[model samples]
Target chain A: MRIEVHLHPPFTQVVGTRTLPVELPDGASLLDLIERLRMDYPNLFPSLRSPEREEEVRSFAIFVGGGEVLPLSYKLREGEVIEIYPPLSGGVVPKLVQKTRRLIC
Target chain B: MNAGYMGKVLFVDLTRRKTWTEPLSEAWARRFIGGSGLGARYLVELSDPGVDPLGPENPLIFMNGPWTATPIPLSGRHEVVAKSPLTGIYGEADAGGHWGTALKKAGYDGVIILGASEEPVYLWIHEEGVEIRDASHLWGLDTYVVDETLRAETAKTAVTCAIGPAGENLVKIAAVMHDGRDARPAARCGLGAVMGAKKLKAIVAMGNRRPPIHDRDGLMASIKAAVPEIKRLAESLSKYGTSGRMTTIEALGDLPIRNWVQGAWKEGAERISGQRMAETILKKQYFCGACVIGCGRDVEITQGPYAGVQGAGPEYEALACLGALTVVDDLEALAYATELCNRLGLDVISTGGVIAFAIECAERGLLPAKVDGIELRWGSPEVVLALIKQIAHRQGLGALLAEGVRKASEDIGGLALEFAIHAKGLELPAHDPRAYNSLAVGYATSNRGACHLQGFSYIFERAVTLPELGYPEIQDRFGVEGKGRFVAVTQDLMCLFDSLKTCKFILFGGIKPTHLLAWFNLVNGWGWDLDRFMEAGERIFNLKRLYNVACGISRKDDTIAPRILTQRRGEGGAATNLPPFGEILSQYYEHRGWSPEGIPTEETVRRLGLEEEAGKLRAKAVMKV
Candidate 1:
């Protein structure tokens, strides 16, 4: 089977990639794939594993595609594109700031 | 007729113990407006061509722009200008809080502080008058305490700008923290040290007089029209906070890791991002005066190792430099270090960079006999925290590091100094200029050393578009093409914002060029249009450049350190991307109409109405020599 991944404002850089076969024993978790990806991308996983304090690793978030995913074991189909977008910033730019008045009001 | 302005310039000479207010002249306001322009005009007049930055001759002026306290979005801001200890040139840092508003309320347009105080004191401004209060007891306290004690003791919630231990110690990178809690820093140019050297603890202002408005009804209606556009942008900010950028910055490989060793932080960036904060630690939110967007995150550490240790919490830069850059993942440690900088009255960016540089030096075996066996190991959160305390007090190895990155690197010696990412003696902020090419120029040519806010090219490079007003499409972040054009345009715009004392976020919020024009027209009753406003911005930029030129900095000096220019991030999204500094700088020189060596050309001087002053300056130079 195959999967499609979505990129925002998608144009430049890598569009998508074909991943390894998704044949897991019975009901392997999504975390299993992430664990696999962790092995695949060591640099990406560097911050996640605190060599000094293992407990600090708990702060990270994993997003599949664009939104939150089910637990890691929530298995993925063969071609599903998994986006392990780590603890990305939300309110990314605009938040509690001075505002312009509403035109309608 | 000064219609919308306070119509006076308040002058305070601490050395002579004299205070006076000068009625505003029509020409000055018409040309310079407020904030950066007024700041530059004032600084140019006060500073000698070759005056020592640390000497008493430096003038620290605080200014507000036309839109400052008006009903415009993010207008609660002001500027501080002095000859910078960091840059050995013109120094300026703009801050946002209620202080700018209070200055207006006190029936003054701007305040120029010159000379030095004989003893430790603070200036108190109420609606009625100004008083020099004894600040002997408040002298050694941290900014938090100074702010709290002033409010408690004086019965006034006066917005205060106070120097911490670093400033009092005359650290070159010391910052003047405004309002105390927001960390709304006038955090560049080492202006805080100027405050400290004056033996001044703080300036507390709370006044009730309203600034006269020309088109009050029209302005109010315009302001009403702006409120919703503001709310839409601010709503996200209030929810996410500024730290919300950590993970994304980390993801983009923009986060500075290990003194800019890598683009991505190894210490899980997402873990410290806003989502994690909201889920794990965030408690309440905070805001400045009339500020709709409250990016201040109040956090509570619970159920973790750092649990129960509570403070305002660590922002992104701290998390980057102290955390990932130092290889420390303890959020508690990051928060503690940030609080320590606040306590010690230090610039967090400079302080963090200092520690990171020290770590690199220590790892490189540059620690000498003076280090007293202190381990400068990278990523050692405990030691990093301890050193932060030490730097504040200038104790042991901390004493050496407290001298800032340049002197510290000089003392440490070896290849370690090469890795020190500094421009104009001040350590660069958390952003790796190497990753963001335009930032290289920003860091190099900033009025204050190594400031990101001064140029703010990152916002443009990172998909922020203001295309409705016809800004060119932000070039590729990794590309150096059109960067000079980008930097020149952005620098002028920043000058405008800095002078206007408006939040940088206002640009992102679609405040429109027309809004600023209207505000300017309303305040000074100047018939100035948008082109004139932009020209004022350009004039201020060149004026600041002239100050640097007078201080003897040349094109040769406008450059990033070897490491930032040559080294590429070893890992992360920005791997293999190095700033095309030389190319961009050449373009920048061309854009500014400067000589290849960075001197302002005669043509530019004439075009900008600086030709008359240029002749006078040349005549003065010959006379002095």
Candidate 2:
């Protein structure tokens, strides 16, 4: 089965493309696809999964076709399109200041 | 003396041209916790329930909370409360900018203005005192010019909260603009019209005083420990501001499109998104005073047809309302329109709602093909821009729209109310109830009408979790179980946020009830536990509801538009969910301890120590009977 993945920034920056195609076994769970992406894109995996807690996915939201937020156990089928977004925090000072602090520290 | 308060409230009578200072009541502060809560308490005591909102009897209040102007992150906000000319009920609005901080520094916790000035005037508040000066020249000016001219005439460091032609003309959708070009607005409930009716042009605050702190070192240490995590959690917001969530919001079916009749507008959503703004006209990020997450955008359109359209870029609400709701996909044009609304001191959400409502009326032939010499068509940038000016100046068809959607639709008559899209007279914010089941109940029971911020229960349904409120994980947006209890709890929590004048975005930074309690205790030297803190919130919410009940609001009035309740998008993320609204509302009433008619029960009033308010309600009920 083939699945289409749409990534928003900063994931797009990490993966170097907004959309990508992946092949998966029939009746594959959503977690299986995440595992596949983790192995395929090592640099992007850190953002998808927590660095400190490997088993825990980061707070980034994932929506299936028509914006349904299904669980990881949900089965994926042929021609499924998945959209991923960064955490919607809705403000600016904290991020820029944090980035600067990271560089300094 | 309270450590975090100035312990003084300034009372000005415009009719008598008299100003007096009264000691802030410690008992009232303890019960209300300042800002909206305190303002509401004062309003209930000082004015009757059914006073004309634009008349001299209505009190216009500007209030700050304990956290305001302190070193606490996201504490630079204030609340404006009045009898709404738009809703005719408990009306309040919140804004973030330096104006609140400046007011705090000027050595007052709040200002209450009564009576109307016979002539145009502006109040200059400084370290010395307040002076009611002539502002005849400042009349009829845009907010930008008023701000600049006020600062130039006063201290350069002073900040001004002013109204423009929209407010001057008594436009019901007018906003009270703060920080000049940065343009933070207490932009709902038609409070600006109240300010205009007072013939008060601007409030300029400049001073060097600071409130005494109870535990400065402890507060600083806690803030330092919390800052790193907050910054990390809110990094995306800092990068893209609030408009960053446009694509995701659209994907989730939360974005209102084509006056909320359309299910999806994928390509159109992307064009007006924050990412698109960053890629195009975003010049820099703007920040309110003491904000750790500066989720404000500063944009400059230096070279387009929108050249000279600079400062205070549109946020998520503006983008959705002015862009998607109208089906206007032109980003540059929308940016210009947003700027124009700010200049004219209009509420973008209400302005967009009225314009979108007018377009639908025209499409159905309920209105003439051309209004005020401009063709009324959806997606026409010129129409949107022209309508904004018309509404602000109250000229032509703009005169009707200036009354806001509810009244305008009533005047238009016949099936127009079906498209009015408001709750208790105030236009709905950009978020649709279909997207989140909780929003339906949240909007309906909100004391100040269909305000998302009043509850913000949708945040828990989307990203954040409130472990303190028993949600260790995100609640199911489509689930019906326990949602009534959930909405009630979150509304109480949000009341604390508003009363404290802290930005709600702190929740996105992982700030919990415990953190908020700790900060409150530290700042005020109060030994309040989590339960006690939450009880205060409940008391505040109930008091406001009691005020509304006195104003003749009942369970029948606690409703949203019929269109929103009955219609489904039928094709998006929220397509099939209609929100079992009746069930949720029943559960909400039970959780809130209110009667089936949505009135606070006698037992509830006793529990919350609101017998005084309940007495008022009983008196009114007896009079009616």
Candidate 3:
């Protein structure tokens, strides 16, 4: 199976041109693909080990096609395009409340 | 109870050119709390059901909450409310930094401007008194320059909230800017236009009076306790700033793209994320008044043809809307557009939406080929920048754009109105609601229209958990049944924070839902139960609702944009799900004790102690029609 990855902003330079092919054992999942990629592009992606994050579980978000990619147990087919992304916060600082901390420098 | 507190509301009747001071009672402050609640109460007293937003009858109030100037993390915030020129509903805006604190220190809780100014002028407040000064020279200046001039003239260190050229021209989406150094905008709901419509340029305050606290020892102790959490805030926010979350919002499929006609910009979304921001222009971090969490970004675009200088950030939502959502991936250009809005005094979110809607219309051949010497195209940062300038200056192409998405569509005469992407004339923020059903209610019921802070159930709805509270789980982000319950609970919790004037970021630390109750227990010594806390929130929410109803909003108004109800994301979290907004709204109505039409029911009015007010508003609304 061959998969392509897309990155945003300045990271577009890190989006590799090489289409790495993986020999999957039957119905290997996205986690498996990520594990394989971890070996190849160790530094390009964010890992579950967030020194700042207090949670115990290795947390990350993945999406394939148009929906949020579920847990690793889900199976993947050949030649499907998957987009991996990370989480961000802070929206809405109602002026009446000014709850949002977002500001210009 | 010290002499330091203003304990009064200063009134400026621009229409009559009269001024008066209304006493602030301990009882009133105790019951209504402050900030949004106080402003809502005053607005209810000031507006008639059918009052024109731009008319002299509409009142603009700049008010601060009780906890505004204290050492609380991300505290020191204030609110502005009026009949919104943009939405024709309730207009509002809020800000932090020296402004709110200075207002309190200047010996006033808030300034209530009762009528239109007869000429261009600005309000200057010192320890002595509040005065209206000629502002004809300052009227057209950008907010930054206005702040500088005001500071220079005041000959003191007072902060300012000033309007720019767009506001001066009465652009419907104008913003009121604060913090001359960092440039914080109370930038939604067109209050700046109100300021502009009245020919008011800025409110400058410089005073030595400190805000009074009932218990200094207790306040000092609380501040000390919150310090640890505040310290940690600097690390998380200072590192990436709020733009840091763009990648995360993109990952969750929450980022709005292509005028919300699409969920993700498969072509260019990632190019504007926080990691991307850091790799490029990010320089120094900025702070609000005493805020340990310096979420403000200082960046310099020292690359390409647009090299050299920097400004504070044009931050998160603006970056998403003006940068990624419109498919305008050029960081420098979007940053420039953000700068233009600051200079022009417009809301960047609405600007982005209006411009994107235009581009979409132009792409669909809805706009005429003869539009202002150029074709508007998606992903073309130049066109976006051109429109921002046009909209700000209200030039030929900009004149139509100045009317905002709704009016622009009407003028252009196309199916463009269908893609305007607003709720009740207010543009939705950069977040896409298709990914989270809770946002449907948040956007629908937002008093100012399509706002996020009113009910920030996003954190609760997402993977971030308050485990001890036993949440409904992140997998249920799209679920409908329990949303009303979640919305109500979060609304109250947020109200308590808004009342206390605490920063929302404090929630990430140990300040859970019950923390407000604990604070009340320790301070003010109110031994109120959780039921009382929740009831206060319900009352405040209901009061705001009644205020809206007084201004002519009804069940017909609280609704989601058609795009969220009918569309599905082809590349993110909501791929297969089209939100049943009507169904969720039905539940929200039930939870809010409102009728199916989204009006507070008679039974609910009585229960919330608002039967008389509701009746009067209902009658007024009917009579207006």
Q: For each candidate, give the interface RMSD after superposing the true interface residues on Cα.
A: 11.4, 7.9, 10.1
Candidate 2 clash pair list: A91-B237, A91-B238, A91-B295, A92-B238, A92-B294, A92-B295, A93-B293, A93-B294, A94-B292, A94-B293
Tens digit of per-residue lDDT, candidate 3, span B343-385 = 7788888888888887888788887544787677778877877
lDDT per residue for candidate 2 within B71-137, as digits (tens), equals: 9999999999999999989899999989999999999999999999989999999989999999999
Give candidate 2 misplaced runs (Cα > 4 Å).
A23-61, A72-79, A90-105, B616-625
Docking class of 3: incorrect
Error of 3 at B530 (Å): 2.8
- The candidate that achieves the highest DockQ relative to the unseen native structure: 2
lDDT of 2 at B353: 95
TM-score of each: 0.84, 0.95, 0.86
Compared with the true structure, all predictions reach lDDT values of 0.69, 0.87, 0.70
Per-residue lDDT of model 1, residues B1-625, tens digit only: 4665677888889998888888876676666667888877777766675666667788888887767667666778888888777667778877777878887777777888888887898888777788888899987888888888887766465677788878888877788887766556777767888888888888888877777777677567666666655554444356666676565566566777877775565346755666566666777776655666666777766665555545566767667767877777766667767777766677777778888887777676676422655666766777777778788777778778777788778876777679877887877777767557789988887766677877887766653443433553434667776788778877887888887667776544445555666666655566776678888888878877776776677777787678888887766667777888889989999988999988889889878887655554554331221
Better of 1 and 3 by lDDT: 3
TM-score between candidate 3 and the true structure: 0.86
Which 10 residues in a row give candidate 2 chain B its minimum summed lDDT?
B616-625
